[model samples]
Target: MEIEYQYHFSLPRSVVWKYIKNERVLKNALPGCRSFSMVSNNIYKAEMDIHIGPIQDLFTLEIRLDEDQAPSLIELHIKGNGNMGQLNGQALLMLKENQGTTMLSCKANGQVTGALGLAGKRILDSSANKGLENFFQILEKEIKRRIYELKRRNR
Candidate 1:
């Protein structure tokens, strides 16, 4: 399956990029996340409880930053297993700056095997889309708060 998303942030590209690279910040963006921590450089471990349709699972995922190009681009690989099944995916993220705002775009592809896979494609797509939207909403608020703090500190 393929997933795509785009978001706009009022912060500058550099600030958004720097803040987003932190594993802690990323963890806070996930919906129903239980725990997220770094294992080594560019490698992260995350646990999340995700619900789709009538099923729910506690997933343990290994996330890796496959490629990074500063404030411009990043690529990620993720693999995980849960009571429902297993999932693996790769995503590419790009950022563009116009004036003071930043535009972020992401493209992801993944496969599922197990009970979760049995949920059907339409259900998976809608569930994933809703999850992504929720994640972005929380992330945007966090980023704006950070920007506000930084500006206040600089004053």
Candidate 2:
């Protein structure tokens, strides 16, 4: 499966980059995430409870920051397993500043095997898109709130 997502933030790229690196913010942005913690430098563990159709399962995922260029780009590799199936994927994130806004984009490719994979491509794609939409919506709201708080404090 392939995943692509893009979001625009009114804040500067630097601010966006800083916020994204925060574990709390990332955890909140990921849909269905129950717990997120750092295991080591640039490596983290997360547990997510997801329900698709009538199936519900808790997945344990390990995420590694494979490559990064501060304030500009980051690459992540993730592996996850659950009673439903197994997932492995790599995602690349790019941040670009234009005027006062920051544009963030991601591209990911992965394989799903086992019960979840039986859902077929169309169903999986639709589910993935909905999940992405929900994730970004939460992220945007948090980013705006944090930016507002920072501005208020600096005043």
Candidate 3:
């Protein structure tokens, strides 16, 4: 499956970058995340509970951030397995600054294996497609609220 998402933040690219790199923020904003911890620099171990239709499972995912470009671009490679299936994806993200704000965009491609894959390609694709839309909206709102609080503190 493939997905693309974009969000605009009323903050500088630097501030937005910090949130993306911070483990706590990432964990909290990530949809379905139960626990996420930094395993090594730029690598994180994540535990999440997700459901598609009536099937639900907990997955332990290993996520790596690559293509270091501070405040500008990033690549996320994730792999995981659960009782339901195996999941793997690569997401390329770009951050651009306009005025004093930032626009973040991501393009991702991945696959599902095992039982989850049996959901039929259309079902899997639609689930992921709809999920990304909802996830991005929620994530952007969380970060925006955080940034607003930070900006308030700076005053």
lDDT: worst 10-residue window of model 3? 132-141
Best by TM-score: 1
Residue 57, model 1: lDDT of 97
Q: Candidates sorted by TM-score, descending order?
A: 1, 2, 3
Q: After superposition, how far is residue 81 of candidate 1 from its true place, in Å?
A: 0.5
Per residue, candidate 2 scores C-alpha lDDT tens digits across 1-155 of 99898887777898887877678888988988999989999899999997666667899999998656887999999999999999899989899999999888989898988888887887777787788778877887888887788899999
TM-score of each: 0.93, 0.90, 0.86
Cα shift from native, residue 140, model 2 (Å)? 1.7
- After superposition of all CA atoms, the RMSD between model 3 and the true structure is 2.1
Q: After superposition, how far is residue 147 of candidate 3 from its true place, in Å?
A: 3.8
Could you tell me the lDDT of residue 103 within candidate 3? 88
Q: Regarding TM-score, does 1 or 2 come out ahead?
A: 1
